[model samples]
Target: MAAKQAERQLVEIFGHAPRDHSSAARTFWQLNACPFIGKECTKFDHTRTICYGTCSVTNAEQEVVICPNRLYENNYEAIRKVGSDVFGDIPFMLFNEYVRIVASGNHQMDCLVALGHNSGKEVKISQLSMDWVIAHIRNQQLVEYVGIEVQSIDITGNYRDAWYAARDMRDSIPASGHGLNWANVHKRLIPQIIRKSLVYSKSLLVKNGLHFIVPEPVYQRFEAIIGANIPLVDRPGKEVIVVHTYDIGPRVEQGRMRRLVLNRELMFDLNEFSKRFISGPNLPPGIALDDKIRSILAVS
Candidate 1:
């Protein structure tokens, strides 16, 4: 199913549905806060007058994370999972903290460190930046780092009406024209991943390849664009790009909100991805140019 809600309903507001109406929900809404990111919601409408804190939406009867920050739930478990996969079970500290530790002559080796906006520094490659850089530190030196990109689906239309309804503590959301921007999969996201993968593949410090963190639905669309038949690698290696997907699992009974559950981790090399890109999406089998011309003439 499309990530777009059939009725543009609000599945989550401030990380909980309007129907929740708990004290925490009320507090978060009143403060215009985002519990996931531990700050005020950054999304605003065209007027920038109010925070539109919708986090996810119902798609195919399941909640799909629409806001990237929502994936920042569970103390960024998704990112930590990737880090552990790349760097093993060592403790990880944000790069800035690691730097401070080094300054204090207490820097520890054989641990994982992350570099990003929150982690102090984000590395840029070929004028483009990955969301995070996770490095493995051994013997107080850089061993290797993995580049990561985090993405969530874009909404095509405003859900301000639903946001307002939710703000009023209503259980129902007004219908809006919002839809998921699936076209972005092939047009923007795929290209960016390809470019970043190319850059990472050539970098000496990047040995573990690039990684993409996306919602399961977005990852599904990605697989469709790249052709589902493409062979997936079993493990991360130099020049391999992995797509990590997460699902906002069904709300537990009487639970305030749904949980972001790690779903699939699919790995593929740049060579394989490029082949699918060059080939492009499949075309109809029975149509002919002459038949199409005749059909157009008939319609005219």
Candidate 2:
């Protein structure tokens, strides 16, 4: 059953289905690129390629190349590490687990995992919404759910320029910042953070919590924004967990590379607003509630 669901999602994203978890993961890796390591380029015919130039830390003498396979492996490893570092060995279930949990209750369901949306239209896969999800069941009924979003410092636009600048500066670049301010947090990262937050705060998806995994610099920038504009106390529908990370090294033997090291974690639970906050109907609009989900929210 889980295999079928996985295949279905794969077909939706790739136009072809995968047979198993390994195949699905491999397909996902092939379809996605590391936002920080290189720039994605498209040819006139619309063929896309990831371009990684010379070693950022070293001079132009040493050409730098990023292996998509390596980047994908590292990205998954980082996400798993963040989960363990923040939640501490808590057993995490895959999307199949979520499906099973919802099925067991015989309740109506409307949930999406690793799916992307843009202004109600299907967009490319959303890296921000692909973390993990858990459904809490009580008395054989679905009660609440939790979702997580992981973020890393990467350039979103003009990848080649940002990549070169970061290499020249030997530091991470922002999603959007002033001229040559590559290290200062880019403008795009903040919006991504807010959109993920709203998936819970404004949407009806996760009722209990929404976690965000980010580097220390990203966390500080996000916190600063929250402090200046939006106070946590005002929002009650969901909780936000910020996982902070640091850079490990540029140890140069053959070439220079860096790994993000996960460190401390902080959270803000909207316990006070959980019950009072407005929630969308149990299922998303236009999606039919079916018996596979127990039909708990089916309209009479």
The prediction achieving the highest TM-score against the true structure is 1
Those runs of model 2 whose alpha carbons end farther than 4 Å from true positions after fitting are 1-50, 53-75, 81-144, 153-188, 201-208, 223-237, 250-252, 255-258, 269-300
Checking candidate 1 for backbone clashes, the offending pairs are none
Residues 34-138, candidate 1: write the lDDT tens digits. Answer: 887678898777788888888987655545678899988866777888898887888888776788778887755688888874677677756787788888888
Point to the candidate with the largest lDDT. Answer: 1
For all candidates in order, the CA lDDT equals: 0.79, 0.37
Cα-based TM-score, every candidate = 0.88, 0.39
lDDT, candidate 1, at 90? 88
TM-score of 2: 0.39
Task: Give a tens-digit lDDT track for model 2, residues 191-243.
Answer: 55455565666546454455655545445545444442222432323555343
Per-residue lDDT for 263 in model 1?
A: 88
Tell me how candidate 2 scores on lDDT: 0.37
Q: How many residue pairs clash in all the candidates, one count each?
A: 0, 12
